[model samples]
Target: MEIQEKKNIYVGVQTTQTRDIRDFFMEIDSYKNILVFAEVGEDKVCDNSLELLGEANRLKNIRNNDSFVIAALVGHNVKKYAPTLFGYGADKVVAFDSPMLEVYRSDLYGEALAGIVRTYHPEIVLVGATALGSELAPTVAAKLRTGLAAHCTALKILDNGQFTQVVPAFGGKVLGDIYIPNHRPQIASIKAGITKKLDYAPKDGVVEDFSCELNGFERMKVTKVEKETETCKSLNEADCIVVGGFGIGSKEEWSKLEELASLLGGANGCTRPVLDAGWVSNEKAMIGTSGVAVRPKAYLGIGVSGAAHHTCGIKDSGLIISINKDENAPIFACSDYKVVADYKKIVPALIEELKARKG
Candidate 1:
């Protein structure tokens, strides 16, 4: 591999795959580390991305003992997070630092990630299926011309060293498994809370600074960067979550859900219709494919009709209890405990019991 000096590259970047499918084959020993794309900010790394370091470590323990856990950090002033990446099970951190790469564009980020894979030759790649990741994962996979399993609920390793990516299919009625048999680097974008993150135990890991061509689509440039107030911080880490559905009834009734979450020391979420109905305004509060994916320890679903889109997000909860008026609602199929009752009656009784216990 050759390293280029920092030059102002004006030409558009290009992607080149190493070999054709028929010709692409490597000895098992040749494939090395498990690469994670560590999405970063100026001050902190994305929680979802940091969590993948732990996932990589677990996968390495079970599937490939010889592989190192390598994390690729790309952004301006992001070298500070490399130690945190190391503390969270990363054995190596590849830093692609540059001022021109401050604002994230899908094309440039995609190119840098793809370049890192080519240089390091990692056996597997994992990314957090975030707003940026959802857009970025497919781009990197396209550049490398490999298969990508999107929004995986779970992952398993086969006896023959191949890994399976588990995702929802058939309108959330069945789970589909995906794998890349012919590709050198198998890639999957995992949900935020699917796996646990390691404790912040600082370790002295290897760090390397590298650069990719910072040239692309010249017409586009980020002139302004606005940061929204982080209101949904607990949604990712909250152990208890109370979710409402379209069947949750009138806007006035929705306030009870918030009250329940507050009493339980949890967070509240709603389905997409709740947003469209003007019952809720925050788009980040919606949980599903278009919103946040959470795997809380306990999930309470009231008046949920069990749509495929919404069920996909909560299917992995530690304990799932749902109350719906209809006994045959699709949500019943996914819940561990179900009650065929109305939320109005059940919620108030539960709230009263909790309040009584407090008093």
Candidate 2:
């Protein structure tokens, strides 16, 4: 926190950006409403999609032309989720349901989302930065010829109606605030867990069906889909996470991290190298841009060198405690607490203390 304060003092947080209405293209004035891509799974709107709606509702400006929170649902039998959208804060829902969208093809989903944006002319477009959304958001933005801010941690609208997008840059060293001052639709893909879902209410909202022909493709075929079975709670759901890195040295060492997590009633995760080393068989346990981004209440790192790729994901953790032998490891800069010691010493002591307390 002191390092961040120093940075804030030396280098101002570049948060303000503005543009005159005259600077905007003539058609830019046509944009209205905050359109959120409502990603549906298992016949229900995904929580990340609901998170986007709640955030959009919170950021919507009525004075700036009554920016309604409009959710664009595109999937097979997605109309069933219209009420769920309304309950979550959507003022209106536009549904595009078809067999083509049943299976997520980037082209198909992108077309559906792009078509919705073109037709709606939304002032802002929000997408959850999931595996699917990371691909779909860029594809739609390209099709619409608009600027998109990907993997944003924060978003806000200035009094001048400029949309601000905040993302971590330089490998979580500093936060970069981006703005789309002239675009008709300011598009952004929000990283999951940055915000929570709104409370459900029996609010009435309008649902509209949008019909369009999608170009067919046989470039790829999915014969069968299988879901990955996770042995531990998802990183997003766990309040605490015990993460191991390649520095763990051996498969046996990695087991200690898992043991710690299990005892704490939390989840276990690893950096990419730990998985590559064959210490972790569950690929879903990797945390980074290549994996899940977690914001747990407490995150304990064992032998983590804190590469930017890994730190970017853990930077938001509430209480980051890194245990490493290297005094100069990069993670110490960002962690709330640091223990310059070997995991072999810290792990056993921690486990013993917990067991003693239990007894």
What RMSD value applies to candidate 2?
5.3
Best by lDDT: 2
RMSD of each: 8.9, 5.3
What Cα-based lDDT does every candidate model obtain?
Answer: 0.80, 0.80
Question: How many residue pairs collide in each prediction?
Answer: 0, 0
TM-score of each model, in listed order: 0.82, 0.83
- Let me know the TM-score candidate 2 reaches against the reference structure: 0.83
Cα-lDDT of candidate 1 = 0.80
* lDDT computed for candidate 2: 0.80
Off by over 4 Å in 1: 1-30, 217-219, 237-239, 250-252, 263-265, 272-278, 288-290, 293-297, 306-312, 315-319, 333-337, 348-359
Clash pairs for candidate 2: none
